[model samples]
Target chain A: MTDSFSGQEKSNAWSIKRRLTILYVVSAFGILLISTVFLYWVLTTRLAKEDGQFLAAKINLLREILAEAPNNKEVLQEEVEWETAPFRLAKYYARILDSRGRVLIETGKMDTVAPSYIFPRPARLGQTPSHAAMRKSTNGHSLLVMTALARVGDSRGQTRILQLALDISHEDELISDYRSRLLLVLLAGILLSAGVGVFVAGRGLKPIEKITRTVQHISAHQLHRRLGQSDWPLELNELAGAFDGMLDRLEDSFNRLTQFSADLAHELRTPINNLIGETEVALSRERVVEDYREVLESSLEEYSRLSHVIESLLFLARAESSEARIEKKLFDPRKEIEDVIEFYEAMAEERGVTVTYRKASAAAGSGFVNADPTFFRQALSNLISNALRYTRQGGKIEIGVEWGTDGGLNISVADNGMGIEPEHLGRIFDRFYRADSSRSENKPGSGLGLAIVKSIMQLHHGSASVKSEPGKGTKVTLSFPD
Target chain B: MRILIVEDESKAAAYLKKGLSENGFVVDTSSEGDGGLALMEKNEYALVILDVMLPGRDGWDILSEIRRRGIATPVLFLTAKDSVQDRVKGLDLGADDYLVKPFAFSELLARVRTVLRRGPVRQPDILNIADLEIDLLRHRAARQGTKLDLTPKEFSLLALLARRCGEVVSRALIADQVWGMNFDSDTNVVDVAVRRLRRKVDDPFEKKLIQTVRGVGYMIEND
Candidate 1:
């Protein structure tokens, strides 16, 4: 029904300016029509009252003369007839009748122009007979005819009928002229309303247009730009703030992505340069079998490093994607961490780092995790090796499980190794972020060890945090939800 | 033993053929999926090494076809997708085993041997390698009746390499089978453990049983 009522897309989907203008015009038109009709009615009523009173007054005067002096001809001709009178009433007719219905006096041509039959019958002999009517004269003039009975002042003590008529064709012409002028005023009012509506609506929606222009200028390269909310009204503040917040988040992620790609290229280039340079040098001249064997082994090592980087990259990518499927199972986290400690035992022993697992004295019981066992172990292994890498001889590493503040489980690995510098503490978990880059150049990590651990924790809907005191120890915790 | 490797990359197929031939298996190679399926149809082989992404009719189709025809040749899927879903899908389609690509050739060799050795494997309680005796039931080892002192994990590592006897076992396999560490780590944990085991198991004897196959893995072989 709304579609049919609208009739067309342009009207139904009118712009705010057009819609407001049309509404203004329609309301103005309605008000003008009603008031114009009311004024016309009031005017019509007043004119009719005046005409009736004029005829009554003339009859009353004529009645007076007939009773006091029935033969007063000059007075009747001047006042009652109004034919040659100097009054502003240009056209009128009067007639008098005797008690037995005989025409006593009448203005010349009163019978021809307004016959007696056209007037209402006079009231029966006593009451002042009063009636007024509109009729076309015999000569095509509009007339208002009225009749009344008046008692004479003479000794006869009889009642006589008096008839009078007035022409109103000039008044009708004046009313029609008033109506056409009113119509012109009404049309002008509607147009002015539409104009005012357009101006007002445009002023109200100017801010939204400004917003569109600002938004159009922003691209991926200009994500840092924001729709500052301070200039907007209260109603638009929320929209502006939300837009700025989205841009903030977008800019942050885009920066991280850009940094990640650069890091990836650098990490990959390191090993490829080595492989190419070493292979090219080896093939520059013939070498002994042992030399060739050594070169090939070195190339194989580079290949393994390249493969490891790819593997870690893939794992990080998969863990970040929402669709990376992790098959969770219920298991004791303490037991899982213990297995990784055992796995890293021999390596730690060679470095004289005693790695062990123990329940935190503050812990209530063995805490379990609904997590993928493979990912959990990998995370723990990375942390253990990171600890082992920095630990000096006789350094100690401890793995502990305890209840978190929020009733979840917290698994921590604390090592009395070389603690990290305070400045590098924050970004240790970023991919390819190395703390002591030159020192860790020949280290066992792929530079993604901690990043992978962080990714794994994220996949479990958990968090990983680190606290370190240089020269004392460093502690890394994985907090899992209850 | 006989095996067929269906792979698209020419270098991968050639190296796989070389490695399997060196391991004493009569190996055949095909670069297309349909051709590999036809080869298996006309010939009887002990096992099929199938690569998942092929030019025509992929590895899954070929494996399903081989199984549909009632041929009992065990198939091991070799593909690059390491997702759990793809692994389950391959196994669900009658693949005997699954090995992800960029695989250590030794791991492939180990899987191939396992697939061909279908059905039950019966072994005596003891495995003898020269004078060294490993008692699988007791979790003890001795050379010429002198019991070697070893930790439980060390004993298990010995048992894993001993089970494969003369075969070269990759470090990843050793880590997984012995310590249950499935992810790749750049640490020398496995190598360190092997060295510790060799100190007790091989250093005092005139003959060494354990050997490091340089950047590949470890093996305990006696001549």
Candidate 2:
């Protein structure tokens, strides 16, 4: 059973660790992905704005030159000089269109490029100097184009549309490079987080592993070992404590079992040794018939003793195993006690012990109880016999039946005899346990009478308890359910 | 009468065989189940004394085989398993009687006799114990030609006690036999009845026939 349980626990531990690692990786990757997308968007938007601004400034310079020139040809000449400036490193193009939509001045680079719809045209002649920026492909190169409607030389009626373009392929390439690098970094971050997650999960489960190891070291033989609860975390400390408690119970039962077996062997050995020694001695000689008869009779006594032990042991075993069925029926408790008292009357008389029965005034008329009469009698008889065994000659043994304080039936056998010590009262019901060990030598019992009584009470779903004080008296109570 | 003993423990088997043989029985012993079964199949025995735990095959299986073959031979189960369920199971399997181990040899003999008496072959109607004679068919008992007045229960109890003469019969057994009671009554009804029976069976006679075995029960034996 433990093997299967541990196997299940191992799988559970593995799954927990795996799940923790997966959870960590998934959340980390999600955050990283969102932040990367946001950063890329911000950088690209800024770059596009800067490009638009640069194109607008270049367009302004062209507008100024066009306004200053006397004719369209001189305007072209000034444009060429402006384009030749050392600061203007990027390839540039420009075109000027009148209000009639006729191109008046065009730069040398503009003639080579196609006339594409890079930006929207102004609705009217001047409409607050409308400006727009767009992208166009020229000669297999991507360019940013900015168009504006400017009033030349401050003439309110005169207006010209200025179109400026700048090659921005380098900026596009830089943005793409940053995007790929961001993706690589995101992958690395996921891997690193997964590794750290696994490490942390393993550390978190270290205490459980330690507990399992400690428990595994404790075999059936070494049940005293415990998982040190002080070293464990709070949750696992509870688990360790539970485990230690279970071990305590196991050790207690194991010790009891070991002791029971040893006691059983000892009890059997005495009678067997007597039988064997007497028989062997008798067989060693050619005895007369009467001598043989005497030997047989002596051996029969030993056999009878052995038989009693076996019978009591079997009864206890059956009771413990739940094989002894108690046929519960409604019967008179007082009548039952009276019957037991009557049964022991002959023996009590022979032993010179006075036995009496008492019924409480509160329970005098009420007699019915749901219990197994035979088992109740058996329990009562056992107690009465014990009382007879311990009570001095001419002493009194009172058997009483009454309603218990808690409302159930209570039958108590109190003997004013050689009482048991207070310490021995608790364990008197243990199998093969003797209250007065010295007095046991003279008592002809299997030392199982009280144990059998206890078992009988248990079979009836009741409880048996004893109270005793030295030099006073002993009282045993069998409390039954209502 | 012939009997077959199937037991694993050699010492127990030997003692059983010796005791039964001394009691005028032709006893055969087997220590294994298969051999015991084979002996049962071949021989006509008065009864079979079987132990529950045996090598080669268990007592339950052997008994089942015997019954399955349509043989109604009586079987008395002798076992160390004294639980009520074991006894019920043995009886359910067609065993005539069940005796727990570490039992008194006298008890075993009495049970064996009871089982054998249940067979189809009828025992003699007359039972003799020294000078006392019990006529079962006529329901009469006499001591030295003097007829003794006895009730039906007293006669049956005396007959049972006389059959297993010189052996102690517990009050529980007497209650079971005479009163047909399976559960003890907590009262000394059996002892009281026996005391009444003893007055009639022994008080008038010079030589007492019924004797009390203290702490046990009663025995009808001549001194």
Query: What is the TM-score of model 1 when looking only at chain B?
Result: 0.96
TM-score of chain B of each: 0.96, 0.70
Worst ten in a row by lDDT for model 1 chain A? A81-90
Give residue A374's lDDT in candidate 1 (0 to 100).
92
The positional error of residue A325 in candidate 2, measured at the CA in angstroms, is 6.0
lDDT of 2 by residue, A365-466 (tens): 485667887777778877887888788888899987777666678889999988998888777898888877776653567888888888888887889998
Score candidate 1 by DockQ. Answer: 0.53
Model 1 deviation from native, Cα RMSD in Å: 9.3
lDDT of 1 by residue, A1-482 (tens): 45764433555467877777788889888998899888888887888888888787777777778777766678766765555234474477888887677887787778898888888777655445344688988888888888778777756667778877887878888778988888888888888888887888789788888887898899999998999989998777898999889889889879878988988898888888988999899999999999889888887778778878888888888888765978788788877787888888888888999988878764445567778999889989999989998889999999988888887778899999889899999889998888887875565678899999999999889899999999998999998777
Model 2: chain B TM-score relative to the native chain B: 0.70
Collision pairs in model 2 = none
| lDDT score, candidate 1, position A245 | 95
CAPRI-style quality class for the chain A–B interface of candidate 2: incorrect
Per-residue lDDT tens digits for candidate 1, residues B160-190, read: 8888987899888888888889788744889
